[model samples]
Target: MTAESALTPTPAANAAGLPLALDAVGGDHGAVPNVDGAVQAARAGVRVMLVGDRVKLHAELSKYPGAAGLPLEVVDAPDVIGMDEHASDVRGRKDASINVAARLVKDGQAAALISMGHSGATMAASLLILGRLPGIDRPAILTHIPAKTGTVALLDAGANADVKATYLAQWARLASTYLKVVEARENPTVGLLSIGEEDHKGNAVTLEAHALLRQQAGINFYGNVEGGDLFKGTTDIVVTDGFTGNIVLKLAEGEARVLFGWIREALGSSARSKLGGLLVRGGLRTVAEKMDPGTYGASILLGVRGLSYIGHGSADARAVKNALLRAARAHQSRLIERLSTELSGPS
Candidate 1:
């Protein structure tokens, strides 16, 4: 479909449009959170299709106070791909919710798909079922990190561990399209992940990929940026291979948790510290809430032909609601089609 057609807003008469197919059987905590989140999304005027065992979903939905009247659908899948199931096994099993949800997207029965399942299995399902956008090698699980200035798109969060220069450039283009859609920033600045801003820096892949990204006329390449610059919001988009991107993501999560733990302990240790914390409790809580990654829903799987999101397994209703809104906005913005066109253009 054309970019304009892909993003045309749903008619006012049908505000919610098609229901989003959610792989309810996929997360580590089984189906409870998934079911609860789906109910929450539906209450917000977003219809949801819960894909899992029909009997189980019905049982859970019935337990919810007002679930019976909600705009929800339950798609039956006899078997669920266990959290520990291999990607191949999940793909081979037709009864898995991941495959079924993907099929819903492919069949035009759903606007998008959301899952807090195995990251590997989600990518595999998107690729094998929805297929990749033309000229896009692998689908990158790109996450939107909230920064002080705004939000930054970090790609290849955990998709392709090993990548080529071409794939890195594709990520830039994909992220650029996303920025245009979400931020409405014309010619959004793009930066490569590296140790320093110097021209000759980083390992073999980054150095070579830096040159390639610079050469790509489509992306507004902003040279090398350090890992510390991620939250600094130095650029609109940060491009890196999946290996480095995954490492940075994990390190950031760990550090954020550690810092919060330290702050909590320090404040509670002594009478003076306790009094000081009480004085600044409101400000500290506000800062911590804003800095929390959970404020931003799951990451977007960019470059795929269909809409799919991978959220954290620990995501609560608030995070899931954000993710659903993001998916809807992505459809409304036509970000995927724009990325496809940009990446398919001359490199």
Candidate 2:
């Protein structure tokens, strides 16, 4: 179809009321992984709309057996926006894959959109196309980080650089709802990122957020939590601005890498070390595999009118499949509509 039709912002809810739009063109590994994920999601009984080059997607579809006659449909667009293109530049490039995915949600063709492409473009396209749910100042990206204790929903991972105490409170609400829908938790503990657990700790913004989150009756605020508390899963949801959340996310990932390297070095140090490594290799591999970010697939861009998942640029087919499953789960759980109401309350 034409670019104007592709960019149209339709409501996400369908007549039957499913909530997911499987973005077939999103991902760093090109259309193979994306199409594979779509096929997998369709097999899993998820409703998906593929938005990308029809020729390439159909060719990929032919490679997979039993993928025929699925509920998936391809909306063709002649152009595609690249991952390197700045988010700001995507609006001018209407045929960008993310834009087409967002349009599916916007025009009532799908309930939500899932993408593994550039996060900036996803957020920008969602905002520019689907617009924000009422009362949400900005759309926040939520990552379901697999922590030491359990998974925690970290918000504003890269949506808004600047934030406010009120926004933090809103994040708490949105994240609480997210955990509830995804993890089936009624009251997930909400933690404000801080230097210490004390009330007086942290910078001006965090301190203010601490007070606001505490006062937010809608959220299950658990008071201040330090950066170290992240992997400990001290809280079910961690609320912070994009700046801090992104940095913390990267650091956590980096530390995981460093530890893996150290283990490798230590395991091969000598014969004695090799023997010791053999003893613990299974357990170590289990932890390493579980802790890998690729295992989680992609992060969800929450607080928008629809589902917009941002996958890692380096994501492989497995990661793509995981993201599609996430999109399906989010749609089944009515995550976006639920989050909108939780964040905005009654009109």
lDDT string for model 2 (191-270, tens) is: 99899899999999999988777778777888999888888899999999899999988888888899999989989999
Which regions in candidate 1 have their CA more than 4 angstroms from the true location?
Answer: 1-16
**What 10-residue stretch in candidate 2 is worst by lDDT?**
2-11
TM-scores for all candidates? 0.92, 0.89
Clash totals for all models, in order?
0, 4
TM-score, structure 2 vs. true: 0.89
Which pairs of residues have clashing backbones in candidate 2?
Answer: 9-106, 10-106, 10-107, 21-112
* Model 1, CA-based lDDT: 0.80
lDDT of 1 at 273: 97
For residues 1-347, could you state the per-residue lDDT of candidate 1 as single tens digits?
42223322343422457777888877777678888877876766667799989999899888899887777889997787677778787657888888999999999898888988887788888889999988788889887665767667898898989999889988898888778876578999898999889979999898899888888877798899888788999998899999989988888788878898999899999999999989999998877766566566678898889899998877776666667666766766666677777766786
Error of model 1, residue 344, in angstroms: 4.0
Candidate 1 TM-score, true structure as reference: 0.92
